[model samples]
Target chain A: MTERKLIVSRRKLLRVGALGAGGLMLSGCDSLNRSEGFRSLLEGAEDLHKGFQRLGGEGALAREFAPSDMSPVFRANGNREIADSAYRQMLAGGFADWALKVDGLVEKPLVLPLAALQSLPQRQQITRHDCVEGWSAIGKWQGPQLSRILDMAGLKPQARYIVFHCADRFGSTPYYESIDLIDAFHPQTILAWRMNDALLPERHGAPIRLRVERQLGYKHAKFVMRIEARDSLAGLHGGKGGYWEDSGDYAWHAGI
Target chain B: MSEAVTSDHFKGGDFVRRHRLSTRIWHWINAVAVLVMLMSGLMIFNAHPRLYWGEYGANSDPAWFEIGSNADGQGLVKIGDATIETTGVLGVWTDSEGVVKKRAFPGWATIPSNYSLADARLWHLAFAWVLGLGVVTYLFWSLLNGHLWRDIRMSRAELHPKHVWHDISEHARLRFPTGAAALKYNILQKLAYSGVLLVLLPVVVVTGLAMSPGMDAWMPWITQVFGGRQSARSVHFLCAFGLVAFFLVHIAMVVLAGPINEVRSMITGNYRLPKDREEG
Candidate 1:
């Protein structure tokens, strides 16, 4: 009788412990997630990841793939087509009049048209684009290195970050992204005008898109209309560096 | 199930030191950290509930494994050519608020319990450091203190099939070691523990680093080792489920071996041996 009673109670205790602890923990985590302090504490890990990533050296390049490795169907994600009339007009006009505005914290502010951008020394590389949504696609991208454009404009010493103002928008908010000077000067960083040997399609950020090869897809702002050199990311939209970072709580440094 | 097996009714042969302080500390910390990482990782998986191979794969690409819902709202898990219906558990389930959710994993099994990939990543990344650092620290300490060789290493004789089969049969019959014999781990325990410490933990960490694009820049060959980033992701997922399988068996063994006593031994580092009896 004593043994049976002990067995029954132990079984009950185990059951209760498993169910109760699991339930309490799940609900407790949800509540803790809502707390600003707790969320910030968790976000603190971003700094550690960033610091460790920088230890790889600034000039280190992301692995590039062969042309044969390119995906047959490279999926276009986010803002496939800008609904704004100004952007639609430019698209309809074949982006002939479209000019990339280069200004802010620069000695010379210049507007380069599509032809001028194409005329610059071009580079083509096949690279894998990793998305934050857990997908990757390889494609050949052709464009001049971003460093060449920055050199053409002559960046000021105070300029610490390069911000890309895009034509796409989510509701009333315009899409934008920023990168540090190290990434800005990266050899692979380019304003890709062509993909997979064809003129860039509208669904895939036609005419031009910022391709920061080392980072996730969201950091590669599409429909890039203006490139501004800024000393800081603050005072920008939502005070975050990119659209997803601002609205979706994505980390501004999306190298991970 | 015997009354004497209860922690409170400890009429055992002797109370012996079964686990060291370092082992106990590492075990408890990992108990929380590993679960957090797994749950949050499931939430992250919910974002794209598909696994593939090679350096590149997206929506249009063929996936080797995927948890998805058809047009009829039936939840299905597909692995290669085989498909399993997993309604109400995965692919499709109702949340705590009584609303239907179309996610890969149930809310109860995920951190934050809602569809927030950002929040899930936060939880996953934060606990990753804890789990990663804990493995490193525990391994270093075990090496320094000779716990790795003294407690976990199996002798050449123990590695023999006959000795292993004997231990397995003993475990199958629930014939647990008694008296002084209970102080040391059998061959099975050593294998499981060593597998977790050396193989599973290290592979999981390395595969995780392989998925990071920034880390890819630092060590491009990491991804290449697994064929590609997506392959690394698949390996990471498999290893996580492998750990889960180990956890389930470990818990069942704890219950069968006397939960109160086993848990107390883990927590307090002291275990009371079962009294040995002569068979008639």
Candidate 2:
């Protein structure tokens, strides 16, 4: 009788917990439905999206397709040419002097040259790149996993966000993007140096570019020049994390 | 049984419950949600005026449908080899500032009444939460209450060609059922409602999910079932248009059949039965 009572009570508790979780989800949607301000609506909806994805996406890997499924033309989106003289010089010397500086809240600061990056063990993935403008293209990318670099850098306990500084600039604003540690540690996240078995071209961000497979196109930072680990995104450009987020209405987190 | 009231001028007149409370609530909420989603979605579609098939499509790829303006400043919508001019409307229209611009889906119909894809997405995703959740919950509740079988499901008699033909012709003539018959759905009504509920709604949601790269991780079959991302998008695009067409027909039927009674029935759940004609 005692054992039976305990099991019944535990089942009741489980029922209540499920009801509460469902109610909480409803309230999250309710606020988005009721909010009048655009910014509040944006923030609330984004959080809802993040929470929904986090529940089921912890260990899930993005779907990979066969090489035969690759798109014939993977059009490079955003800023076609870099006007900066330093980037041109790096291009001229074939990125011989170019190096990615990884600093900020890290136990060890490391600057890895292009050659050093290529020397690391690489993971090749053929994944589709989805653009916010409603276009998709599949391309194979090979590079060192971002998790490996973070392991080598040894992030300090205070580190919460990893910001990517880039050589490419859109108009006057230098391009940059940031991601939470969860995304930073994803196995598929890589600083790719090669596309389709060839060296990464300038239009696709040479030397190295970040390939976050699960996100929209803009989050894949091209012409990446630096990586900084930080505690908060508060003081970053536009305080929202990415160049597009600052200038346009693009969501900083494009997981959806 | 024809029951005559104290006044025998009208026979078999009575009040009937046409919709449940939950159904009414879902219906009203869906009205707002679908409108918001549709308008914002138009703005998102404006970002890419061209539509294609297969796995990939961009400026370089061959397009099956496109909205563009010609050199003489005339707007046109092109689908395959055929083209139709739509100046001052879809392809080319002046904004609030009165400056003529070449754009798909003019500003008025879009959210914010401006060209902001970011804000448009915010509105789209925001209302999509309501639209998606409402449908799912409503369907669940409907099943538990046997509302699907009791009301939505058609009877064997309903599938008879003669019964369907009668309903279709009556609806075409703008003549609706009266008295006790008005309590249950006619054949045409059941077909339209079932089409919207079981077919169009699910197709739009699935194809929309298939477009999301994140969802690709969760359900690879979502993309696979639709063939590819671009193919899914095209299907999603067509389904949305189908929904809009349904909405137009719904509104028109309501108006022609007597908006006061139809709208009141949906709102308050009490419908006043139309007068029965004798010798019919």
Candidate 3:
């Protein structure tokens, strides 16, 4: 009889204990779910994100090279070149007629030919390309600094971002990417014209490609056809900027 | 009925049988995932071959102790024909000379740097995604169904120091009062589970992601949070330590609780409760 009573009392105590534990856990959940606190946390996280970008300043550009460090095998990732007839024809002609059209929010819209781009003072750099899928390769790249081109075209004061329009298309929509002015004028930022002392191959981005060296492989926009300076990206295709950005929700600032 | 008779065979009462199918699947999956993660994680850690923190980075000065070879020539032993060497600045060391040496710090075996970091990273990342998805889905399901707020949650009464002390004392004596007493998870289980889920997992994920150069742009705070990339790596290892500790305690508890019945319920999603022998 005494054992039965002890068990009954213990059972009641256990119930109370469980109830107490449940209450503590709820308080923790409440802290996490608080609207204002959560929002502030996100804002703080974004600020820290920007701070990192600033820390890797324009001076933090990838090292320039003398064509020696280029890998003997610069294995191409994904498609070598678009199978589209138009792109193929351009490639056949050695891309002499190709021009990089810079327009949108620039004071002086310019259609600079590939030859004209080469005439400008060029910078060469050896840098590592880190792929998002987790591989890294060091290669040599030579090109005009993007800052000089933007300056030549004369970006409008209102222009806050520069969008790279590429010849490569995922399907019906052509591939395009955008970056804020901070990245736009970064000294390391260049429109690479040559790789390993040779003209950029069709498999690579033939006439021109943007080498935002600080970012991942996807950010390296190849087959550049146009440059659009803009304040707002809301009007762009899918409003996310890049193909992967639209499809995979890739974070816009893919800096390492 | 047959079901009732079968239910009477297990200890812990009817509550033990109430685990849902989803819960059972997640439980076993987590078990397997954790084991794989731990083993692979250990193998990866072996590469760096040494552990340190704060101002004491892997190559930092004030040399704590170095692995591989040492001046004292201690902590060396032959396993099979291969002569393996060990040394210490602290703790104890047996040298290649068959002499035992003692010091303030211990030199550890340089993990055989055999595996490719890239491959190890691939395995770690892929398994991490599986672990992450499982956790996210489990948390979401539990929250939606109020399980988070109810089952594993602690009530105000349980928070009382006196109550906690009483439970601790009871646990020390191995006197688990059965029946309705077993209806809810004990306070110890609640604390351990909550710590593992809420704290350790997040720390592990954050430290791991922080080490990535790709996400460094959007999540630079990771570097700041963990001091630097190397520090983040250290923290990641520490968090792994905490997780392994929790896992050991968890397995031990399951064994003590009744390994066969616990394992069966987790696997088969059914448990027979223990009843009075007289009633049978």
RMSD (CA, angstroms), candidate 2:
10.7
- TM-scores of the models, in the order given: 0.93, 0.89, 0.49
Clashes of each: 0, 0, 34
Pick by lDDT: which candidate is best? 1
The DockQ-based CAPRI class assigned to model 3 is incorrect
**Per-residue lDDT over B90-125 for candidate 1, one digit per residue giving the tens place of the 0 to 100 score:** 898888888878899999999979889999998988
Q: In candidate 3, what are the lDDT values of residues B54-129, reduced to their tens digit?
A: 2113322121222344455454332234545544432345444555544322212111112233333333544666
Q: In candidate 3, which residue ranges exceed 4 Å CA deviation?
A: A1-48, A55-59, A62-72, B1-280
Whole-model lDDT values for every prediction: 0.88, 0.82, 0.64
lDDT by residue (A25-107, candidate 3, tens digit) is 33432343244654344334333444645654434544333345334456566446888887788788977767889999998
Candidate 1 residue spans exceeding 4 A from truth: A1-20, B1-12, B277-280
DockQ per model, Cα:
0.66, 0.25, 0.06
Return whichever of 2 and 3 wins on lDDT.
Answer: 2
Docking class of 1: medium
Candidate ranking under DockQ, highest first, comes to: 1, 2, 3
- For model 1 chain B, the run of ten residues with the poorest summed lDDT: B1-10
